[model samples]
Each structure stands twice: as C-alpha cells, then as structure tokens.
Target chain A: MENEGRRKFLGVCVAGATAAAAVAAGYPVFRYLAPRSGQGGAAKLVIPVGELKEGDAKFFEFAGSSAVLIKTQSGELVALSAVCTHLGCIVQWVKEKQQFLCPCHGGQFSTDGTVLGGPPPRPLAKIPLTVTEGNITIG
Target chain B: MIRKNTLAILLLASLAFLKPALAAPVEQPETVCIQCHGTLPDRLGAPVKLWRSSIHADNGISCNGCHGGDPKDAANAMTPQRGFLGAPKEKDIPGFCGRCHPGVYKDYLSSAHGRALGAGGPTCVTCHGNHQVVKASLALINEKSCTRCHSFDRARAIRDAMQQTEGYIDDISRRIADFQVSGVDTEKMGKSLFSVRNRFHTLFHDVDVARVKGESAAINKELGKLDAALKEIEQSHQKRRVAGGIAVGFMVLLALLFHLMKKSYD
Candidate 1:
C-alpha cells in the first residue's frame, strides 16, 4: 500500500508540471500562429509627388483604409479624412465643384475638408504629411 | 469510492486544459483599435456616431483593426479577456501607433509632453485617451489642453512675447535692405557697430533667447552713434561740394567781367 501511494503521488506531480508547461509555452505560440486580422502596426507608405496634380485628389491605402491626398491650386498639399463624417461613408472628390461628395447621404466637403453641406457634423480630419526627396508621404 | 475521487481529480485536470481552448476562441474587437472605434457601415449596420468626426474615423481605420480578436462576431459579441491574441500591452500603445503615424509620433516624442511620457511622464491615454479618441484639431484649439502641461502662466506669456518679437523682426527685415554703399567703410566703425548689425541679423533669424532678453537695446544704442557719425561724414561732403560750387561760380563771373572790359577797351 505504501509503495502504491508513493507512485500515485509522483504521477500527480508529473501531470501538474506538464499542465503548467503547456500553459506557459502554448500562449506565445498561439499568438504568433493566429491570423493577424486586426490592425497591428503602422506601415510606412511612399507616394511620388508627380502622381498628384494641382487641384486634384488621389486616394491611397494606409493602415488598411483609404487616405486622401489633395493638392490645392495654391500648391498646398493636404491630407484629409476620406471617410465621410456623417456615417462612415467614403467621400469622393467632385472635380467640377472642387469638393468631396458622399454618395450615401449627400454630404459635401470643401477641398480643405470642411463640411459644406449635408449631415456631416464636423470638418474632415487632417493627416500629418511629410515631403522627402520630392515624394509626399502621408501618415 | 476511491475510483470516484480519482475520477474527480482527472476531470478537473482535463477541464483546465479545455478552459484555454474555449477561451482562445473568444474574439476581442477592441484590441485592434488605437482609440475607441465602432463598426464600419459597409460591413455592419451598427452606428459609430461619435467616431464619425474623429481623426481615426477620417483615416479609414475601424475598431477591429487595432484591438484584434474577432471583429466579425457581431451576433455574440465577445468580452475582452486578459492575455488574448489581440490585446496590446499598455506600454506598447505609443510604439504601435508610431509604426505608421511616425511623424506625429516623432513630434510627440520630441515635444515636452512626449519627453515627459518617456521619462515617466503621462502616458498616451493621459492626453489623448484610450477610448473615445477624438480629432486632434479640436484638442489643439482648446487652450485648456495646453494649460494642463504648461500650468504656469508666466512661461506661456514669455513664449507669446518671444513669438511677437520674432514676427516684428521679420516685418522690419522685409522693409529694409542689408546692402551697404561702396564708399562706406563699415569695418572701421569698431565692434559696437558690428555688434548692432549682428544683433539685427539674429533678430531677423528669430533667435528667441536674444530677442526676449532685450539684448538688441545695447546694439541699437551703438547703431545710433554710428548713424550720427555717418551723418557727420555726409555733412562734411555736402559742405565741400557747396564750397567747390561757390569757387567755380566766382571764377566764371570774374572771367566774364575781364573779357567784357577788354572788349570795351579795344
């Protein structure tokens, strides 16, 4: 009986240790193996200035969404929120009117990203821009 | 009875293993979000009213992108569990955002507030917040936001005054030309004159420290003396020109009178 009890105790200890190790090692591996479905980190994107013309706007992908780049006639480069302020609709540039128009709710925004009409309650958000070697990078 | 006890222990151990498997399947949509955000309109009908005008909203980034876990699980929303696949450590917030928004993050890092955050200063949440991240433009316009870091009015005043002085110097420089005439010997005027010119140049360049301390006063005083000397030189030149003109006038008159007298005698 004494020998049997000692063997059971040893078995239990081994099982517990195995469980602890499994827990410890399993987590990091799970995180690493899991699909990165969410936004993880900021990715650097480079855009050539030549691609953007004065009084013209271009949309590019950054951080899994569209970022709008507009060059005014005054040669001022502005990066604004392309996402509609009303209900998260994508705002498109109306070349004739020189404003951003939302198809979902008729929201209107000036070239500078100010809400001109419709349900948009605020001005478009400005993104920080940097020019390096004649390339315009927006973050 | 002994078998039952052993079975109970075994069941508990097995349950512990199954616990993680069940928990791992739970999704946390907030993990991917840098600031509190809501669902996208195209994907889900849920309204993110506040996020519409937010800076994050403008950038086209949605909630599920940063917070991690599963954003698609709208039917049975999963509560965030600690140590999950998408949850970020509090310390990693700045760096996580810095990856793409490097310029803003760089500015924040170099700013006083940024330095404070690095040296045990307020974390990103302290100023920007964790959830409900709004647009920076609104925050930037709020004077109270600045006062939180610069609590002292005197420091703010000094900063404002220095900015005003620098602007005045720019205006002055636009109106005056730096060119000196060829005849003027500016070097022989001594260190005082040069010091004044140097101060003016510094002011034009917007050297905040020198402008604020009134260092230009001494330089201006020396410039005044130099101006007086220049005026004295100009006056001497004018006097010599006048004397030469008078001498020429007298010589022309005397020659004319002599010629007339000779003609009469003939």
Candidate 2:
C-alpha cells in the first residue's frame, strides 16, 4: 500500500513539474512568434506641418534611426536620413547654403539627398512622407 | 646626386615614422597616370609610390580623382578640355584641397594659420603632406611639428584639453565595435559617435585653446551619455547570462529528480 501511494505521488509530481517546464519554455516562444505592437518600432509618426518653415529642418527618430524633415527654400517638403554615406555620421543642414553637410568628412548633399561634393560615395537616403490636414505623416 | 639621394631617404624615413596608421592601398586598375608616371625615374615616378599608402589611395581616389582628368581615355587624359587640372602651386593648395574639404578650408582661412597663408605660413601640404596624407590625429600636434613656426605652448595646451575627450571617444568606439562584432545593430550609436569625433577633430583647426576647453566639456558630456548606454547593455548581458545559468541548473535538477523516480520504480 505504501509503495503504491509513493509511486502515485511521484508520478503526479513529475507530471506537474513537466507541465511547468513546458509552460516556462513555450511562453517565450509564443511571445516571440506573436505579432509586435504598433509602437514597437514600426508605427507611423505624425508631425505638425506648422512646426517647419521655409529652409527649416526638423530631426527626429523614425523607425529607430535618425531622420530629418526639411522644408526647402522653394517651399518643398523633403525627408531624408540624416546619416552620412561616407562614414555614417549625421549630416547637418546648412540653412544659408540650403544643403546638407556631413561634419565627418565635409560630404555635401542637396535637399533631394543627392551627393553634391566631398568624399561621400553616395547620396543620403530618402524617407517617404506625406502632408495632410496640416500634419506630416512619416513611415 | 648622393646628397639628393640621402635627402630622399630621410624624407621617406620621416614619413614612415609619422604615419603609423597608413592603410594598405585598395586595389584599383592601373590608370594612365600610374602606368605612365610609374615608370619614370626619380621625382616623376615617386608620386605613384608615395600615393600608394595614402588615405586617398585606400579610398580609391586615384590621381585622376583630384586632378580631374579622364581616366578612361589615355589620349585625352591630359588635355585641357578633358578637365585636367595639373599640380597646384603652393598658394593654391588650400583652394585645391578646399574643393572637397570646404569646412576645414573655411576654418583654416579664419585661423592664424590661414591668415599667414602665402607668406611662409603652413598650407595644408605643410602639415598634412601632399601625396601621403594620413588620417589626422592629436599626434599631428607634436612639439617638433608645432615648434617649426611658433612655440609649442599653445599647441600643447590644446592637445592637453582634447586628450581626455579623445580617450573617451576611443573607448566608446571600441565598445561599439565590440557590440557590432557580436551582431548588435549599432548603426545609430555609431553614427552619433562619428559625428562627435569629427566635430572634435575639426575644433583643432581653430587652434584656440579656450574654445577647445569649453567645447571639450560639452563633448565629454555627450560621451558620458553614450558610456551610460553601453554600461546598460553590459548589465543586460550579465543578467541574461545569470538567467541562463539558473535555467540550466534547474533543468539538470529536474533531470536528476526524474532519474531518481525511475530508479525507485525499479
């Protein structure tokens, strides 16, 4: 009788422990497989259009990297990755010259992100954006 | 002839000593400039060999890149219409190099060095060299180089001010590189660091000790923030390691318990 009782108890304990272990392992896998929340790095950003003016640039984090929104002197809105192509340094917008200049190696870029001069082998990357209802929406 | 050879030897030796970080030349197809000038004796062929170790060469900026000639066409390579600009004179070196490094050129123009240009003042070639220009560093502000034109006191002061911040930058850079090697997405942090480093180096062109001291404090604050981020990453890694160890230990203990239960049945 004693042996039977002990055996039954051990079996129950083993099954319970196994179930607990399975849950501990499966929860992480389930979380990993689940769809991420919108705020988890892929959400669209909205900025007020009034915050920018002619020949002005506003730098902000987009999709987890540095990006910029610029209003050119011609009243055109442009979005570009602020990262310089030469050495990955952030480019500064020169309001006077109406161009982007990489402080790292003096790489120059026009408002459209095209490489104008210096050692940069390529242009700054362009980010897509839209203006609607006095708000700028970027992805 | 012996004296000339000795001077050339001395120059080469000094350059080798000065440029400890010379990068290996990036392989490129031979251009007409290299093909033709590489064979000529003495002064004519020397530029090709000297340029082989330059930062420009490492970036694949061949003779034609700066000289503005058609590298594809040997016949029209040197023609005026082909947009070839021959070697610049001493006075025009700043303008020539400034075509690309306009910010540095502008800073140089406003500096004491810039004001002294054309009247025995050091042009870009004086310190940076003409063909064998390496990456700029605090090493360029040595007593021997600075004392050539003026006293080393001001240069020494500026270098002292920058040394701590430079150390911070280098340490953070190494940490970032380590993270990158481990497959972490370090692009954003790396770019910010690069901008800070470049801006710090550009401050040297101004040659003002007070400004360097003032700006270095701000730069150090930025570096401190980055250092804190790196520290947070390190802490997270440690926590993960400990958690992994506990998980393994728990699994092993459960295995032992299962074995014990099986033995009891037998």
Candidate 3:
C-alpha cells in the first residue's frame, strides 16, 4: 500500500510540473505566431513639381486611396484629400473661380483648403506631403 | 505500526512538495482564460482586435488581473474556493484600479463626479458601469461622450456663430482675390494680414508662450481688430452688390423707354 501511494504522489507531481511548463512556454509562442490585421504595406508615389501647373490640381493613387495635389496661383504646393467632408464627393479645382468646388452640393473650399461655403463640416483632410529633389511624394 | 509510521512520513513529504507547488503565487490563473477571453468578439461580431495596443497585453497584465481564482479548471473558477482573487467590490474597485492607474484616479478625484463620490455620491461604476467595459475609440469619445453634455442646441449655436464668421471671412477673401487680380499694391494690407496670421499661429498652434511673451494676449487683441475690419469689408461688399443691381435695373429701364419712343415715332 505504501509503495503504491508513493508512486501515485510522484506521478501527480510530475504531471503538475509538466502542465505548468506547457502553459508558460505555450502562450508567448501563440501570441507571436498569431496573424496581424490592418498593417498597411509600403507604397511608392512620386510626382514632379514642374509638371503641376499653377492653380491646377492632380490626383495620385497611393496606400489604397486617392490623394490630391494642388499648386496654388502663388506657386505654393499643397496636398489634400479629394474626398469631401460632407458626403464623400470628389472635389475639383475650379481655376476660373480659384477654389475647390464639390459638384455634389456646391460646397466651395478656399485655395488653402478652408471651407468657404456650403455644407462641408470641416476643411479638407490634409495628407502629409514631402518635396524631394523637385519630386512631390504623398502618403 | 511500522507500516502506519512509514505511511505518515510519506503523506508529510507529499504535502510538503504540494505546498510549494500550490504556493507558487497561484501562477496567475489566467493562462487559459486568455486563450478564449483574450480574443472575444467585438460588438460588430468581429474579433476584439488591438491586443497589441491594449495596456494588459503591453504591460504583461493578463486576464487574471480582473477575474481571479484558478483558471486551470473552469469549475474552480466558477465556485471561487479559498485563495480567490476575483472581481473586487464596487467600493474597493477604485483602489484596485488605482494601483495601476493612479493618474486617472487623481484626475477623477478632482472632477465634479469625483467630488460627488467623495461626498457619498455614486462610485466610478455609476457613470462608466462595470462588466461591460468596452474599448474607448475616437468616434465613441467625440460622438457619444461629448454630445451628451454639449447638447444639440449648444452645438447648433456654436455652428451658426462659426458660419457667420466664416461668411465674413469669405467676403474678405474675395476682396483680397479681386485686389490681386486687379494688380493693386496690397503690400500694406499684406503686412497687417501677416501680423494677424502670426498671432493666430502662435496662439492656436504654438501654445508655449513663456519663451514668446505677450503672444497669446496679442493674438486676442489682433484678432479682434481683424474681425472688425472683416465686418467693415462685408458691409462694403453688401453696398457694392446693391448698387450694382440698381445700376443694371436703371440701364434696362432706359433701353425699354428708348424702344417705346422709337415705336411711337414710326
């Protein structure tokens, strides 16, 4: 009876230790191996400054979306979203009026992207743009 | 008797070994809890992602931090036998949470709700609630929380004021555009505009003003003057529009009279 009890106790101890070890080692590996979502990949987009005329705007596709590039009459370059704040209407540069006009609701935005009139709740969303060696890169 | 003595010794040794294993600080009963609870679905039935951004996951805090008792067995977790470290009481909840988030607790204590709580008001669970703790998102913060206190009327009033001011700005901008188009020397006007712009940039964006003394107050004063000038410009534009309309109407009337005279002569 004593030998049997001893064997049973030893078995329980070994099993408990194994279980603990498995739990400790298994978790970090599980987390590390887990697949991640929403990690946006790299994108390459480049537009020459000289190509964009004064008071004109251009659009480029990067990072799975469209970005608008505007060159003001003062020769200053700014990049903003073509997506309107009201209902996602695409805004176009109206050179005659010198403003960004959304054809959807007559929403007008200033040359600097400030909401001038109509139903836009806020200014146009600005995407960070960089000028490198006369090349305009937006993300 | 000899066999009984040996049995007692073996039992004592077994207890000794088990004591150390059991006392291993309960081994954070959450090892298994995280397997299921950690990846629980969100409200949209999608998985409650952002585990990487979570404070629990970042600081090595696990599910066991809140729901205690041994997680190895579901039965033990449910019953919560001795050595249970389960959900704390509502009163003790603050202290328990404060252990990790003292800054938030301090801020809360100074707030109106915190003062009320101190004066025997409702606990933290009163406003935030318990068990149904969802992740706070930007949309949630802006839409749900702020609107609750701000009210529709207040929001509408603010929006109306903003629109009125924006209209005045549009008139000024149009004038500036016209002046530029007509080749007017707006150098003096540009100097004033730059000053106002500098003040606005300093106040709104660059808030550190000890290094730049009197900037914030200067911005307020300059903005007041700019607003007055904008109001004057709006009035002038209104006058111009009315005058232009009158002139067009008079010209049309004269043309009509000339045609009538020509017909009578014939």
Candidate 4:
C-alpha cells in the first residue's frame, strides 16, 4: 500500500513539475509576444490662465510625449505636440516669426498645427483645451 | 611616345573602378559603333571603354542614343545624314546633356553656373566629367571643387548647415536597414526616408543657403517620426529581455521543486 502511495505521489510530482514548467515558460512567451499597451500619462491637466501670457509658450508632457502650449501675439492660446509630425523632432516656438519652426527640415507649423510652409505635410496637431474661471485644462 | 603609352595604361587601369549609375540591360547586336571602335588603339578605344560602364550604357544608350546612326550599316555610320553628333561645343554641352535631363537642364540654365558657361565660367564638364560622371553628391560642394570657380565660404556654410541633418538621416537609414536584416517590415520606412532624402538633395541644386536653412527643420521633423518608431522597437526588445530573465528564473524554481519531489520518493 505504501509503495503504491509513493508511485502516485511521484507521478503527481512529475506531472505537476511538467505543468509548472510549461506555464512558467508559456506565460512569459505570451507576454513577450503580446502587443504593447498604451502607456500614456495623465489624461487631463489644468493650468492657470495667467500662467501663459500673450506671445508666451509652455512645454508639458501630454500623453507619452512632450506637448507645447503657446499664447500668440494676439493673446490667443494654442496647444500642440512638441513632436513634429514629419520626423518626430521637437518643434520650436519661433516667437519672433510667430510660428512653430522645426529644426530638422525647416517645416513651419501654424499655431493650430496646420502646415504653414516647408516640407511638413500636415498641420501641428491640436490638443483639445478648455479655459474657465481663469484656469486652463488640457487633455 | 612614352607619355602616350603611360596615358593609355592609366586609362585602362581607371576602367576597372568604373560603376554604372543605375541598372539596365546590356544586350544588343554588335552595332557599327562598337564593331569598328572595338579593335582601335587605346587612345580611341578609351572612350568606348568608359562609355560601357556609364549610366547611358546601363540603360542601353549606345552610339545611336546620343549620336544617331544606322547601327546595322557601317557605310553611313559617320554620315551627318544619319544624325551622328560628333562632339558638342563647350556652350552646347548643356543642351546636349539637357536632351535627357531636361528638368536639371532647365534648373541649370537659370543657375549662376550655367550663366557663366564657356566664358571663363565652369560648364557641365567642370564638375561632372565628360564620360566619367559618377553620382552627384555633397562632396561636389567641397572647397577643392568650388574654390576652382569662386570662394567656398558660402558653399561651406551651406554644407555646415546641412551636414548634421544629413548625418542624422543616414543614421536613421542604417538603423532601418538593420531592422530589415532582422526581419522587420521596414520597406515603408525606407521609402519614406528615400523620398525625404531626394527632396533634400533637390535643395542642393538650388544652392540657396537661406532656403536650405529654412527647410532643414521640416526635414528633421520627418526623420524624427522614423526615429520614434525605431525607438519603440528597441523598447520592445528590452521588454523581451526582461521577460526572458523571468522565464529563466521560473525554470530554475521548477527544477528545485522536481529535485525535492525526487528526494521525497527516495
């Protein structure tokens, strides 16, 4: 009876070990093969209205990458991805030119992310922003 | 006599390094041009040899392509009625070459270089040789070549403003190629880069520093997207390494558990 019990226990051990090995190996392989999840940052952010003045600009993280908020000379607010749509280089707010200038290929973006000139095929992407009670919020 | 022999040897040696600009079929019946010229002395045959490896030759542009003639009949090969243009004058060189490169010819005509053609000014042959024209590159804008015409300060400035971005584009290209070799679907990215690179090279023809500087930012932005995509791939690779490590640890644990179970049975 004890020998039979030993046999059963050994069989269980072998089966358990084999199953454990499979799960251990398979789980990681699945994880590795699976598509990456969207790892973006905060969905929404609020900024004080007075913090950004006319002709001023602010760069903050939007989603997983950098974004820019600019106050044009006309006291208008504009928000866009700091990343250029063309090659992903950061777009600079050319305050003097009153346009977003890309350093990589001289692509110019209007305050609204519309391609004003140069090789940029698309406009600067606009981030939805809401202003209320002297506070600005961005998503 | 010695100088002639030395020149012949040099010409023959240079032929070994010649490369066609692009691929094209090289099959055809032996034409009147190649037939008679094939057995000529090195002095006359040097041009034929050089022409063989030219972009024209690769595209099957034979003696008839530029110098029109009845290839099959040797009698009327050199006859003007057969439309054989022996050689172009210095000024006519642009129009001769323009017969094919019309766009570049038009651009060149309005350019400063074309304006000065034949009157102490550099012609098409000044930079691109007669029969040995290789691919045009930024190297053509260097001091030695430009200084031959005028000061290279402006040219140097143009190159400096562009060299970093050009290098960045090249680096991205190499990265894409590496990914391709590793079985990644990088064909689209390669084509995208190629288009931008071609556009950037077109700016070289303009030779306007202000314009090049102005457009550089946009080009850089385009390259940035490619870089981000590559970076994402690299991140995935890093994740794979981490997952692989955890998997190895699990295997070790499983081995220990099996050992304990064996001891129990023993």
Candidate 5:
C-alpha cells in the first residue's frame, strides 16, 4: 500500500513537471498568437485650426511615422508624410525654397508632395486631412 | 590517412557552395548589345564584362536602358532608327545622365564642375566613372581624386562637414539592420533611414559647406527621433530577455525538484 502511494506520488510529480515545461515553452507561443490591442493603424489626430499660419510649418508624429502640416504663403494647407521616399529619412521644410528637402540624400519635394528635385524616386506621401469645426483632423 | 584525404575533399567541395556567385550569376538580359558583342573581342566585350560588377548592372540597368536601343531586336539594335543613342559627347555627358538623375545633374551643372564643362573641367565621368560606375560615397571626394583638378581644401572641408552626420547615419543603419535580423518589424523605419541617408548623400553634389552645416542639424533631429524609437524597442527586448532568464531558472528548479522526488521514492 505504501509503495502504491509512492508510485502515485512520483507519477503526479512527473505529470506536474511535464505540464510546467509545456507552459514555460507554450506561454510565449500563446502570447505571440494572442490578438494585440491598441496596435492598429494610426489613430485619428485632432489639431486645433489656425495652429499653423500661412508660410508656417509644423512637424508632428502621426500614424507611427513623421508627418508635416504646412500652410503655404498663399494660405494653402498641405499635409504630407515627412518621410523621404528614396530611403525614408524625415525631410526638413526648406522655407525659402518652399519645398521639403531630404537631408539624407538631398531629395526635394514640393509642399504638395510632388518630386521637385533630388534622388527621391517618388514624391512625399500625402496624408488625407480635413478641417472640421476649428480643428484639423487626420487619421 | 584516408580520413584526412576525405576531410580535404569535403572542404574543397564545400567551398564551391560557399560562394554566392556560384549559386547564381547575374544574368545579362538577352539584349541585342549582349547578343552580338558578348563573345566579340576586347573592345566590344570588355565593357559588358566590366559592367557585371557595376551598381548599374546589379540594379538591372543594361546597355539598352542607357543607350536607348531596342533591347528586343538584335538587327535594329544599333541602328539609330530604333532609338539607339550610341554615346554622348563629353560636353553632353551631364544631360545624358541627367535624364534619370535630374537632381544630381542640376546640382552638378550649377557647381564649379558643371561651369567648367568642356573647358578641361571634370564631368560626370570624371568623378563617377562611366559604365563601371560604383555606388557614390564620401571616398569619391578624397584628396587623391579631387586634387587632380583643383585644391583639395574646399572638398576636404565639405567632407569634414558631412562626416559626423554620416557616422550617425551608419550607426543607426547598423542598429536598425540588427533589429531586422532579429525578426523585428523595422521595415518602415529602415525605409525612413534610407530616404534620409540618400537625401543627405545627394547634398555632396551641391558642394556647399554652409548648406551642409545647416542641413546636418535637421537631419540629426530626424535621426534623434528614430534613435528614440529604436531605444524603446531595445528596452522591451531587454525586459523579455530577463523574463526568459527567470523562466529558465524556474524550469531548472522544477527539474531539480523532480530529481529529488525520484530519489526519495528510490
């Protein structure tokens, strides 16, 4: 009877160990398979209207990437991904040239996201933006 | 003795597989230029052979792409009727390359080099070689090469101004690449770094020290943002590693417990 108890106890210990090993290995696998929350596409960004004046520009993070909102001298609101298309360096607003200049490789783009000059294979990506009730809304 | 010989043979055989070129060669597209002249003598076939190592060749820019010939037709390939432009004159070299690299061409034209074209000045071929063109870098602006024409002081200054930023770019690029190797989703960030690096490198064409100085700050600022993002990822990875270590310890402890339980039963 005592031997039986010992056999049962050893069996339980082995089972417990196997279960522990499986959990240790499988926990990461399950976590990897689990659905992630709040990691979707860029959430909507709301900026107050008139935040940028004509000939003024502001760079901000949007959609987990660099974005720029510029009001041209003629009061044209232009929003574009500041990411340079050639290799993905954030472009700086060259106010005098009225163009976005990528410093990494000298790729230039017009405020409207047109390839002006430089090595940028394509123009800057334009982010769809709208002005609703004194605020600029961007997704 | 037999084992040693066998080991040697195996090592030599393994070397054949080690070489990537042996795995697959960079095949030249079956264009008329290649079809007729590929097997011809040195003058004609040498460029084809030399072009294999060029950046153009790697990127699939063949003879027809640049010379404007009919790639598909062998007979009408060089016949000017098929849009074949054999070669550009020294004076027109800028415009020729400018067809594709508009920005670099424009900057080159406006610089001292462009103004000196045809007047014993260095053209695109002078700095960036023709046909055998490699990827452009700061090494191209060195004393030995630039001193061939004028003083190296100005060129060296330009190189100096851009060196620190280039170092930063290289470092960030290595870090991003390492993260990518570890299965991180760094595609967007990698592309962003590339655009910035490319844009910055193109500035060398302008040969303007002041502009380089002013632009470096903006680039550094942008790079700083990337650095911050990468740092956050690294911290998360570190946390995961610590958790992994603790889990491993627990596994070892459980194994020890099982061993002790088994011995107790015995």
Candidate 6:
C-alpha cells in the first residue's frame, strides 16, 4: 500500500513537472511567433499637400531619422532620406540648384535621389509615400 | 637542401604575384594617366607616385577626375574636346579644386588667407600640398607648417581649442565604429557625428579664433548628446548580459531540481 502511494506520488510529480516545463518552453516561442503590438506608432507620417511648393523641400523626421519631401520643378512629388550615403551627413536642399547638397563632403543628389557628383558611392535612399485626400502620407 | 630553397623561392614569388589580387579592389581602374605617367622619370613621374598615397587616391579620385579628361581614351584624354583641364595656375588652384569642395573653397576665399591669395597668401595647395594631400588634422597647424607664413602663437591657440573638440569627435567615432563592428545599426549616430566633424573641420578655413571658441562650445554640446546616447546603449547591453546570466542560472537550477526529484523517486 505504501509502495502504491509512492508510485502515485511520483506520477503526479512527473506530470506536473512536465506541464511546467512545457509552459516554460512554449510561452517564449509563442511570444516570438505572435504578431507584435504597437508596431506602427510614428512609423507613418502625414503632411498636407500644400506644404511643399514646386522646387521646394520640407525636411522632417520620418521613422526615427531625417527625411525630406520634395516637389520637383516639374511638379513631381518625391521623398528621400536626408542622410548622405558618403558619411551619413544630412543633406540640404539648394533652392537655386534644386538638388540636395551634403555639407560634409559636398556629395550632391538630384530630386529623385540620384547621385549627381562628389564622393557619395550611392544615391540618397528613397522613402515610400503617397498622396491621399490632399494629405501626403510617408512611411 | 638546394631543392627545398628553390621551392621556397617559387612559393614566395607566387605569393607576391597574388598579393595584388588579395588586397583591396581598386575602385577606380588604371586610367590612361596612370598608365602613361607611371613610366616617366623625375618631375613627370613624381605626381603618380605622390598621388598614389593621397587622400584623393584613397577616395578613387584619379587624374581625370580633377584634371577633367576621358580616363578611358588615351589619345583624347588631354584634348579640350574631351573636357580636359590639364593643370591650373597657382592663382586658379582654389577654383580648380573648388569644383568639388565648394564650401571649403568659399570659406577659404573669405578668410585672411584668401585675401592674400595673389600677393602673398597661401592657396589650397600651399598648405594641403599639390597631389600628396592627406586627411587634415590639428597636426597640420604645427610650428613647422604654420611658422612658414606667420607666428605659431595664434595658430597654436586655435589648434589647441580645435584639438580638444577633435579628440571628442574621434572618441565618439571610434565608439560608433565599435558598435558597428558588433552589428549594431550606428548609421544615424555615425551620420550625426560626420556632419558635426565636417562642420568643425571646415571652421578652420574661416580662421576666426573667437568664432572657433564659440562654435567649439556648441559642437561640444552636440558631442555630449551623442556620448549620452552611447552610454544608454551600454547600460542596456549590461542589463541584457545580467538577464542572460539569470536565465541561465534559472535553467540550471531547474535541471538540478528535476535531477534530485528523479533520484528521490529512483
């Protein structure tokens, strides 16, 4: 009777321990596989269409870094990261030249983010954006 | 013994031939300018050797890049139709180099040095050198270089002030590079540092001591912010390490508990 009681006790302990181990291992995996909450806060930005004029650029923070929204002389809307590809300096828009100029190493880029000249190995990165109901949304 | 020595010699020779291929790839291909000028003697050949060690060469700025010629075509390389500008006169050096470094050129022209450009003031080449220009540093403001034109006292004061801030920038840059090597995304911070460094370095061309002091304070404030951000990351990494240790300890303890329970049951 005492042996039967010991075996019963051992079975309970094993079952409980196994359940605890499964929970411990599976919870983290579940969390890892689950969709994250609060993923898009400040990830999307909105600016009014009227804010940018032809040949004008408006620099603002986008997705945690400096980004610029530009309306080309041809009235085409474009968005690009302001950071220069050469050494990561923020580029300034030259109103006269209608191009982005990096103050650091004089790396120049066109409105479309093409490297026009200087030491920048690559062009400025383009950011996706869209105009909807007179509000420009950038991501 | 003779056979072994010959084998070693052959191995060394082969390794020497392979060294170029194993080294960093040349971003700019061997231009016609290098092909021709590399062979000539004395002054004609001197620039090629000097320029090979230049900051320009490191940045892939070949002869055709500055002189304006077709790097590919040898015959048309120096032709005016190919947009070749051979060499600028002493007075035109600023404008020539200014084609790329517009901000520095503008600042240089406005400084005391620029005012004395033709009469006695130094041009870009005067301090930076012609083809052997390396990266600029506070070392350039030493007695040897600066005393050539004026007393080292004022230059020394400016250099001292600039050197302090440059030290901060260099430290921050090294820290950021360490983070980058460890696979952290340091792009934003690196760029911020670069912008500040560029602004600080270019401030020298203005040659205003009071302005330098004023701007150095402001730039130091910016550097402080970057330093604080790095500190924050360091703290978080420490916390992570501690948490990892705790997790490992917990796992080991759980294993031991299970092992004891099994032993008791057995």
The candidate scoring highest on lDDT is 6
Encode model 3's per-residue lDDT on B165-208: one tens digit a residue: 33443455466555544444444344344433323322211212
Off by over 4 Å in 2: A1-69, A79-81, A94-97, A116-139, B1-41, B73-76, B261-266
Compared with the true structure, all predictions reach lDDT values of 0.57, 0.84, 0.56, 0.75, 0.82, 0.85
Query: What lDDT score is found at residue B140 in candidate 3?
Result: 24
Model 4 segments more than 4 A misplaced: A1-139, B1-106, B118-120, B123-125, B128-136, B248-266
Q: Could you give candidate 2's per-residue lDDT for residues A75-100 as a string of tens digits?
A: 89999999888877778889999999
Question: For each candidate, what's the DockQ?
Answer: 0.01, 0.38, 0.01, 0.05, 0.25, 0.34
lDDT (10s digit) by residue, model 2, range B4-67: 9999999998777644233244678988988888898899999989988888888788998888
**Where is model 4 chain B poorest over a 10-residue stretch in terms of lDDT?**
B15-24
Minimal lDDT window, size 10, model 5 chain A = A99-108
Of the candidates shown, which would achieve the greatest TM-score relative to the real structure?
2
Displacement of residue B167 (Cα, Å) in model 2 is 0.5
Better of 1 and 2 by lDDT: 2
Summarize candidate 4's per-residue lDDT along B54-161 as a digit string, tens digits.
766664567776667778789999888888888788899878876654445655677777777777777677777776565555677788988987999988988988
**Model 1 alpha-carbon drift over 4 Å, by segment:** A1-42, A121-123, B1-266
In order, the interface RMSDs are 55.8, 2.7, 49.1, 9.9, 5.3, 4.0
TM-scores of chain A in all candidate models: 0.69, 0.70, 0.69, 0.69, 0.70, 0.77
Tens digits of per-residue lDDT for model 5, A1-139: 7766776777787788789778878988998998778776678888887688778789999977889999899987888998878767777888888888765446779989999876678878888889889899887
Comparing 1 and 5 on DockQ, the stronger one = 5
RMSD of each: 42.5, 11.5, 36.5, 15.8, 7.5, 7.7
Pull out the clashing pairs in model 6.
none
Model 5 shows how many backbone clashes? Answer: 18
- Locate the minimum summed-lDDT window of 10 residues in model 2 chain A: A35-44
